[model samples]
Target: MAFELPPPLAELRTRVRAFVDDAVIPAEKAILEEDREKKRDTLNALRERTRAEGLFVPHLPKEHGGLGLGIMGMCALFREMGRSPVGAACFNCDAPDQGNMDLLLKAAAPAVRERWLAPLARGEITSGFAMTEPAPGAGADPSNLKTRATKVDGGWLIDGHKWYTTGGGDASFLIVMARTSDDPRTGATMFVVDRQADGVEHVRDVPVMSPPILQHREAELRFNSVRIGDDAVLGGVGEGFRLAQARLVPARLTHCMRWLGWADRALHMCREYVLTRESFGKTLAHHQMIQKKIADAVSGIHAGNLMTIHCASMLEQGLDKEARPYSSMAKNHVARLLCQILDDAIQMHGSLGYSEDMPFSLWYRFARSARIADGPDEVHDVVVARDFLRGALTTLV
Candidate 1:
C-alpha cells in the first residue's frame, strides 16, 4: 500500500533525473545528428560519465557492475532516464540489451554468462534478439516460426530469415529464436551466435519511421546453415517460448517505465508552455480545454505507472506465468497512454509541437512504434481478453 520509494532508491532517482536532464538531454543533438563521428564521440564520453557516477547498468546486479536494483527499482530509475530518448542507453540499460542481460542472468548458463553477459553488463558490447521474421514467418506472432535450427554434427545448423533484429547489424552477439521442433509453442529454442560467425549475414539496417538511432538500429539478418555447439543454447531446448516470456514480462514493463518518462517530460513541456503562452484572452493554462488536457495527462500517467509497478511487483514475487496477462494489460494501456500524452502535449503546443524546435515530433514516431514493438496493441488486447475469458477472478489491485 505504500507508494514511497525507499530512501536509497529515492536518492538514486534524484541522481538519475539530474544526470538525464543535465548531461543526457543536452547531448541529444550531437549524439543523434547526421555526423556519425560526432555521435560516436558523444556516446563514448557519455558512457564514461555514467560509469563514474556509479549509475551504469542500474537494473543489473551488483556483481555485474550494476546497482543491483530489481524490477521495481528499475521501473523508478528507468522512468527518470526515459525522459530523453537516449537516457537509458547512457547507462547501458536500454532495450534489447537490457532485456537480453536480464534473460542471460536468469536463463543463461554460467559459461555463457562469463563469455557474453559479463561484457554486455559492463557496456563493452551490444546484443540483439532475433525472433521476428519476414512475412509468412514469426513476427508479432512467435507461434509461426519459420527459422529452424536442426541437429547436426558437433552442433545445430541454424537456417532462417530474420528482420527487425534490433542491433544485430553490429552487435557483438545475438540471441536468436529458431524452430527446433514441430509444436508451435514448445518447438522453438534460443541460440547465441557471434556476429562474426560463419554464415551469419547482416544484410542492412531497415529504414523505419524514426531516424537513425545510434542505440537502436533494426537489422535484417540471414542464418544460412550457421553452426554452433550446444553451448550456445540458452535456458534449454524446447524452452524458447518460456524463456522469451520470462524476458518479455519484465521487458514490456521496463519499456513502459522508460517511455512513461518520455511522455511525462513532454507533458511537462506543455505545462511550461501553457503557463506563459496567451490564447484568445488569457494564458493557455487558464483555458478550460487546456486544463482538461493537463488533468487527463496527469491521471493517465499516474494510472499507467501504477499498473506498471503492480506488474513488476508480481514478477519480483516469482509470478512469471501469472504476470504475463498483467504485463500485456500494462503494455496495452501504457503504450496507448504514451501516444495520447505525447499527442496531447503536441496539441497544447500547437504548431510549435509539429515543428522540429521541440523533441515532440521525433518522440511521436518512437511512441507510435511501442504499439507494435513487443506485440501489437491487438495482440496484447487478445492476451488480456483470452486470460479473462477463461474465467479468472483476481484483479491487479
Candidate 2:
C-alpha cells in the first residue's frame, strides 16, 4: 500500500462501493438487452440517483455540482463506478468530458463558462476534445501537428483534420487543438467550436472493437475554415501545450484507476468461473497454472493501484513537473497490466472467454485500447527515459 485513506474517504468508499454493486452494476443489463430507449431511461434515473447521493460529477468543484474532492478524492468514486460498463457515465465523470471540464474550470472565461461549461456540467450537452489528428499529423507526438489556426480579423480561422475524437459525432461542441506558429513549444492553441458552426463537418463515426455505445464512439471531423470568435479561446494563445498537460496528466492517471477497477471485475469473473468449472481431476481454480495467473494479476493490480495513488498525490500537491515521471510510469504500467490481466482471464476461460457470449471478449476489446489511448505505451516509456536523463528525479514515488 502507498498510503492510508482518511477515515472519511474510507467510509465514503464503502458507501460508493455499495451503490455500485447494488445499483449501477444491475443497470448493465440494459447493454445486453440492446434497448436504447430503456438504456437511456435507466441512465437518466441513475443520474438522478447519483446526484441525490452527492456522487455525480465527482471530479468537478462543489460550485459546479461536484464534490470538490480534488484529484485524490474522486479516485475512489471512479474506481467503484468503473465496475459497470455504464457506471462512470451515469455520474457524469467519464473521460473527454471529464478532462474537458477540468480545463474549462481552470481556463475558460466567466461568460464562456456560463454559456458552455454550465450546460455541460449539468449534462445538457456533450463535448469532444479534438487533438489527435490523422496519420501524417499529430497522434502521440504533438510536434507533428499540422492543423493550422490562422489569425483572422476579430477571431481565428481553424482548418484541420481530426480522427478518433471521442463523442464527436453527437457532441454539441468540440475543443480543437490547432497549431498557431512554427515554434514547436508554443505553436499550438485550443478553441471551442460549435458542432453546427459553418464549415464544420462530421465525416463519420469510426467503428471500433468495442460495442457501438455513445461513450466509446470514435469519430472523424473536419474544420474547413470554420471560424470561432476570440471568446472561444480556452486558456491563452500559445498556451495549448501547457493547458493540455494540465488536462492530460491528471486524465491519464484517472484512466488508470477506472481501468484498474474494471480489471478487478474481470478477475472476479474468472475466479467464480474457475471454481465452478472442473478440469482434469479437480476444479480449474486448483490448477497450478491457474493459481499462478491469479497470483500475478493480483500483485500487478496492487502495484498499479499504488502507483496511481502516488502520482495523484503529486498532482494534489501541485508538483506538476515532479509528477510527470511518475504519471508516465503509471500509465504505461497500468495499460500493459490491463491487457495481460484480461488475456490471462480469457486464457483461463478457454473457449467461453473467446466467444462473444461472454463478458471477457467485450472486456478485452476495452482493455486492448488502453495501450493506445491517452498516449501509447511506447510514448510513455520514452517519456520515462527522457525525464530520468533530464534529472527530473523527485517524482519517483
Candidate 3:
C-alpha cells in the first residue's frame, strides 16, 4: 500500500521535526546530569512549551486535550519526535505514560478518568505500568506473576515485589497487575495503586546503561499489604492479562515508530561524518565498506518504516485483534534493525560515535533495551512462527 499522510498530519509532522531539531536537541547537552529533579524540571518546561505550541499528547483523543490523531497520524508524527531522545517526553507521548493513558482512557471508571486520566492527558502527572516482576515472578511469562491482591473489608490488599517498573520513581500512580485467584488464565487483575499508598514502596532505581530519565529509569517496587479501594480496579476483575495485551500491542508499535525516527537520525549523522571525514586520502563515503554500511542502514530503516506504517494503518482500521501477528513481526524486525543501524552508525564515526559527544552512543544504549522491552524479540519471533505453523497467519501485505 502507498502510505501518505493527510495534509494536516503532514504539516504536524513537519512542525514536530522542527521542534525537535530546534528545541529538544539543543536541550540534551544542557541537561546531561543524572539528577532526577533537574531532568524532570527540564522536561516539564519543554512539555509546557510543547503544549503552548499545540503539539502535546498527539496520540490521545481530541476531547482529552490532545490532537486525537489516529494510529497512522501518530506513526507520522512520532517518527519526527523520535529524532531527539527527549522528543516524546516533551510532547507528553512518552511510554509507560502514553501506554498508561491509553489504558485508563479505555478501562478506567468515570471517576477514575476524572481524577487520573484528565491530569495525565494534560501532562500534569506521569504514570507507570507495573506488570513485569523480579525473578520467581512474572517476567516474559505473565502466568508466573507472584503478586497477589486479596479481597479485604473496603479494598484489595496487594502484596508483591516488582522490578523493571518503568518510570516508577516519578510516577504519580501505577497500574499494577496482580493475581486474585488460582486460575492462571482468569486469575489476574489490574489495580491503580497510588505511588504514596501505604506499603507501596519505591525501591532504588535499577542501574542500566541508558540515561536516567523518568521514562527510562527502571525501578524495583515492593507492594506489601498495599490497600486500594475496589474502585481502583482498572477494568473488570480477572481481566488483567487481556487488558495488558490490548495496551501493549499498540504501545509496541509506537515504540517502533519513535525508534525508526531515531535510527533515521543516526543514519543522517553517519552520512554527514562519512562525507567530511577522510580515510586513506579520500572521504570515507567513497569507500566500499562505508558505502555498504550506509546502504544497509538506509534499506533496513526503510523496510522497518514500511512495516510500522502497515501496522499503524491496520490499527487505524480497528484491526488490532487480527493485527497481533503483524504487530509482533514489525516490533521484532524494527527493534533489531534499530540496534544494527545505530551500531553501524557508530562504526562509521569511529571513536567519535562511541563517545558521549554524539547522540549515537546514547541512542545505542536506549535501542539496546528495545530488544527486551515490551516483549523480547525471542517471544515475538515465537508468536509469528507459531501462528504461521498453525496456518493462522494473516496477510500482512
lDDT of each model, Cα atoms only? 0.88, 0.85, 0.87
What ranges in model 1 sit over 4 Å off?
34-38, 393-396
What lDDT does model 2 reach? Answer: 0.85
RMSD of each predicted structure: 1.4, 1.8, 1.5
Better of 1 and 2 by TM-score: 1
Ranking by TM-score: 1, 3, 2
Better of 1 and 3 by lDDT: 1
Q: lDDT of model 2 at residue 123?
A: 79
Which is superior by lDDT, 2 or 3? 3
- Strongest candidate by lDDT: 1
Q: Indicate whether candidate 2 or candidate 3 has the larger TM-score.
A: 3
Cα lDDT of model 1 by residue, 30-55, tens digit: 88873344237787789899999999
Q: What is the lDDT of residue 29 in candidate 2?
A: 72
Over the stretch 216-307, how does candidate 3's per-residue lDDT look in tens digits? 78989999999899899989899998998889999989999998898898888888889999899999999999999888888989988888
Query: Candidate 1 vs candidate 2: which has greater lDDT?
Result: 1
Best-to-worst ranking by lDDT: 1, 3, 2
Alpha-carbon shift of residue 298 in model 3 (angstroms): 0.9
